[model samples]
Target: MFFKRGMLVTQAILLNMVQLLTVLLLAPLVKGWINRSNALFQSRRGPSVWQPYYDIFKLLRKDSVIPEQASWIFTFAPYIYFTVPLVVALLIPVLTTFPLFMAFMGDMLGGGFILSLGGFFLVLAALDTGSAFCGLGSSRARFVSFMAEPVLMLVFFTVSLVAQSTIPYIVNQAFAGPALILAPSHILVVLAFFLVVLAEIGRIPVDNPATHQEPSMIDEGRTMEHSGRHLGLLRWGADMKLFVLLTIWLNVLVTPWGLVGSAAPLAVALAITALLGKMAVAAFLIAFIEGCFAKLRLLRIAEYLGAAFVISLLAVITYTMGI
Candidate 1:
C-alpha cells in the first residue's frame, strides 16, 4: 500500500510539472496570436506569431543594464513577477480536471493575493528607480489597482456564493453543469472578470502595450528601466500572467468542458488542443474589440472599472435572489 501511495504521489508531481511547463512555454504564443490578430484587423502585416519567442531568446542572450541608483528591489522584481504566474498555475485547473500536486495548496483568493504581491514588488522597484516616468507609471498602476480590487473582491464573493467555495477547481466543477453555465449571475461575473483582466493586463481601452509614448504608458512605464534578461523575464512573466488569467476565464468561468479528467497522454494532448482553439477564438474577439474601441482617457478608467464592480455587485444580489 505504501508503494502504491508513493506512485500516486509521483504521478501527481509529474502532472504538476507538466502543467507548469505548459504555462511557461505556451504563454508567449498566446500573446503572439493576439498581436497577429490585432494586426490583421488593422490591415497591417504584423510580426510572426513566433516573434515573442525570438525576442525572449535574444533578450536572454544579452546583458541587463541596471540603473546605478537602483536598489536590490530593481533586480529582484523580475524574478518575482516571472514566478508569480507559475505559482498560480499550480492552483488552477489548467489542462486537467483532476487536482495535481499542490493543487489544494491555495484557492482563487490566495492566487489573487500572490499575483498582487508580485505586482507590489514591481511597483516598488519602479518607484525605487527615481525616474519620473517610472514614478508616474507606478502611481497610475496603484490607482488602477485601487479601483480594480473592489471589483475583484465582488467577483470572488459572487463566485463563492454560486460555487460555495473559493477554490478554483471546485468552482470549475460547479459551473460545469448546464444550469449554472446559463445562469444570469455567471454571465455578469464573466463580463466583470473580463473587464478586470483587460485593465490588469494593460490591454486596449485601459493602456496600450504597443505604445511607448511615455505619457500614456501605465504598464510599460513600470518596466521601462529594465533591460536584457530582466526585461525578458518581465515580458515573459506578463505573457504567462495573461495566459493563466485567460485559462481561469476560459476553463473556470467560460467553457469548462475541455479539461481532461485524467493524466493519460492522449487526454492531455486533446486538452491542450482544445485550449489552443479556445485561446484563438479569444484572441480574435479581443482584436475585434480593440479595433472597435479607442483607449479610454486615464481619468475615465475609474468609471470603466466602476462599471465592472457594479455589475459584479448586481450579480451577487441576483444570485442571492436565486436568479
Candidate 2:
C-alpha cells in the first residue's frame, strides 16, 4: 500500500511539472498568434508566428547592459517578475481540474494576491532604475492597477457567491454547471471580467503591447532600461502573464468545458486540446477588437475602469436579487 501511494505521488509530481512547462512554453505562441491575427486584419503580413521564441533566444545569448546608478532591485526584478506568474499558473487549473501539487497553497483570492505581489515588485524595479520613462510608466501602471484591482476583486467575490468558495477549480466546476452559465448574475460577471482581462493584459484602449511611443505606452516604458537577458526574461514573463490570465478567463470563467475531472490520460489529453481551441478563438476575438479600437488616453482609462467596476457591482446586486 505504501509503495502504491508513493507511485501515485510521483505521478502527480510529474503531471505538475508537465503542466508548468506547458504554460511557460505556450505563452509566447499565444502572443504570436494575437500579433499575427492583428496583422491579417490590417491586410499585411506580420512576423512569423514563432518570432517570439526566436527573439527570446537571441536576447538570452546577448549580454545585459545596466545603468551605473541602478540598484540590486533593478537587476533582480526580472526574475521575480517571471517567477510570480509561473507560481500562479501552478495554482490555477490550466491542464487538469484535479488538484495537483501546491493545490493547498490558496484559491482564487490567494492567486490574485500573488499576482498583485508580482506587480508590486515590477513597480519597485521600475523605480529602482530611476529613469524618467520608467518612473512615468510605473506611475501610470499603478494608477490603472489601483482602479482595476478593486473591480477585479469584486468580480471574484461575485463569482464566489455562486461557488460558495474562492478556490479556482471549484469555481470552474461551478461555472461548468448549466444553471450557473445561464444565470444573469454569472453572465454579467463574465462580461465584467473580460473587460478586466483587456486592461490587465495591457490590451487596446488600456495600453498597447506593440508601441514604444511614450505618449501611449505603459508596459513598454517600464522595460526601457532592460536589455539582453533581463529584457528577455521581462518579455517572456509578460507573455506568460498574458497566457495565465487568458487561461483563467477561458477555462475558468468563460468556457469551462473539457477540463479533466479525473486523472485519466485520455481525458487530460482531450482537455488540453479543448483548451487550445478556446484560446485560439479568444486570441482572434481580442486581436479583432484591438485592431478596431484606439488606445484611450491616460485620464480616460479611469472612466473605462469605472465602467468595469459598476458592471461588477451590478453583478453582485443581480445575484442578491436571485435573478
Candidate 3:
C-alpha cells in the first residue's frame, strides 16, 4: 500500500511539472495568435505568430534600466507578477480533469486571491516610480479592478451554487453534465465571466493594448518604468495570466470536454491537441471583438463592468430560484 501511495505521489508531481511547462511555453504563442488574428481582421499582414517568442528572447538578452528613485518594490514586483500565474497554473485544471498534487492546496477563490496579490504589488511598483504616466495608468487599472471584482465574486458565487464546490477540478466535473452546461444560469455566468476576462486582461472595450499613448494607457502604463529582463518578465507574466484565465474559462467554466481524464500518454497527447484547437477558436473570437470594437472612454469603463456585475448577479438569482 505504501509503495502504491508513493507511486501516486510521483505521478502527480510529474503531472504538475507538465502543467507548469505547458503554461510557460505556450503562453507567448497564444498571444502571438491573437495579434495575428486581429491583424488579419484588419487586412494587414502582422508579425509572425512566433514574434512574441523572439521578443522575449531579445528582452532577456538586454539589461534592465532602474529608475533612480525606485525602491525594492519596483525590483520585487516583476518577480512576483511573473511567478503568481505559474502558481495559479498548478491550482487550476490546466491539462487534466483530475486534481494534481498541489491542486488541494488552493481552491478557485484562493487562486483568485493569489492572482490579486501579484496585481497589488504591481500597483505599488507603478506608484513607486512616481512617474505621472505610471500613476495615471495604475489609477485607471485600480479603478477597473474595483469595478470588475464584484462581477468575479458573483461569478464564483454562481459557480459554487451550481457545482457546490470552489475546487476547479470538481467544478469542471460538475459542468461536464449536459443538464448543468445548458442551464440558463450557466449561460449567464459564462457571459459575465467573459466580460470580466476582457477587463482583467486589458483587451478591447476596456483598454487598447495596441495603443501606448500615455493619457490613454491603462495596463501598459503600469509597466512603463520597466525595461530589459524585467520588462520581459512582466510581458511574459501578462501572457501567462491570459493563458491561465482562458484555460480556466474553457476547461472549467465553459466545458471540460477536451481535458485528459486519466494518466495515459496517448490521452495526454490528444488532450493537448484538443486544448490548442479550442484556444485557437477562442483567440479568433477575441480578435473579432478587438477588431470591431473601440475602447471605451475612461469615464464609461464603470458602466461596462457594471453590466457584467448585473449579469453575474442575475446568474446567482436564477440559479438559487431554480430558473
Candidate 4:
C-alpha cells in the first residue's frame, strides 16, 4: 500500500510539471496567433505567427539596460511578475480537471490574490523606475484594476454560490452539466466575466496592447523602461497571464467539457488537444472584436467596468430568484 501511494504521488508530480511546461511553451503561440488574426482583419499582412517566440528568443540573447535611478525592485520585478502568473497557471484547470500536485494551494479567491500580487509588484516596479511613462502607465493600470477587481470577485462569488466551493476544478465540474449552462445566473456571470476578460487582457475598448503612445498605453507603459531579457520575461509573463485567464474563461466558464478526469495518458493528450482548439477559437473571436471596436477613452473605462459590475450583481440576483 505504501508503494502504491508513492507511485501515485510521483504521477501527480509528473502531471503538474507537464501542465506547467505546456502553459509556458504555448502562451507565446497564443499571443502570436492573436496578432496574426488582428493583422488579417485589417487586410495587412502581419508578421509571422511565430513572431512572439522569435521575439522572446531574441530578447533572451540580448542585454537588459537598467535606469541608474532604478532600485532592486526594478531588477527583481520581472522575476516576480513572471512567477505570479506561473502560480496562477498551476492553480487553474488548464489541461485537466483533476487536481494536480498544487491542487490544494487555494481556490478561485486564492488565484485572484496571486494575480493581484503580480499586478501590485508591477506597479511598484514601475514606480521604482521613476520614468514618466512608467508612472503614467502604472497609475492608469491601478485605476482600471480598482474598478475591475471588485466585479471579478463578485463574478467568482456568484459561481461559488452555485458550485458551493471556491475551488476552480470543482467549479468547472459543477457547471459542466447542461442544466447549469442554460441557467440565467450562469449566463449572466459568463457575460460579466467576458467583459472582465476584455478589460483584464487589455483588449479593444479597454486598452490597446499594440499601441505605444503615452496617452493610449496601460500594460505596455509599465514595461517601457525594460529591455532585453527583463522585457522578455515581462512579455512572456503577460502572455502566460493572458493564456491562463483565457483558459479559465473557455474551459471553466464556457464549455468545461473536454478536460480530462482520469490519469490515463490518452485522456490527458486528448484533453490538451481540445484545450488548444478552444483557445484558437477564443483568439479568433478576440481578434474580430478588436478589429470591430475602437478604444474607449480612459475616463469612459469606468462606465464600461461599472456595466460589468451591474451585470454581475444581476447574476447573483438571478441565482437567488431562481431565474
lDDT of each: 0.92, 0.87, 0.92, 0.90
List candidate 3 segments past 4 Å from native.
Answer: none
Q: Candidate 2, residue 185: CA error in Å?
A: 0.8
Q: Per-candidate TM vs. native?
A: 0.98, 0.97, 0.98, 0.98
lDDT (10s digit) by residue, model 2, range 109-134: 78878877777888888888888988
RMSD of candidates 1 onward, in order: 0.8, 1.1, 1.0, 1.0
251-314, model 1: which lDDT tens digit per residue? Answer: 9999988999988888998998999999999888888889999989999999999999999999
What stretches of model 1 exceed 4 Å from their correct place? Answer: none
Worst 10 residues of 4 by lDDT: 95-104
Which portions of model 4 miss their true places by more than 4 Å?
none
Kindly provide the TM-score of model 2 when superposed on the true structure, using C-alpha atoms: 0.97
lDDT of 4 by residue, 1-323 (tens): 99999989988887888788888998999999899999999998999989999999999899999999999999898999899888988888888887776867888878888987888988999999899999999999999988999999999999999888878888898888887888889989999998998898788889999887987899889999999999999889989989988988998899988988887888888988898899899999999999999999999999999999999999999899877
Q: Residue 181 in candidate 3 has what lDDT?
A: 95
Better of 2 and 3 by TM-score: 3
Writing each residue's lDDT as its tens digit, candidate 3 over 1-323 gives 99999988888888888889989999999999999999999999999999999999999899999999999999999999999999999999888988887888998888888987888899999999999999999999999998888888889988999999989999999999887999999999999999999999999999999998899999999999999999999999999999998998999988678888788878887887888888899999999999889999998989999999999999988988988
CA shift of 23, model 4, Å: 0.8
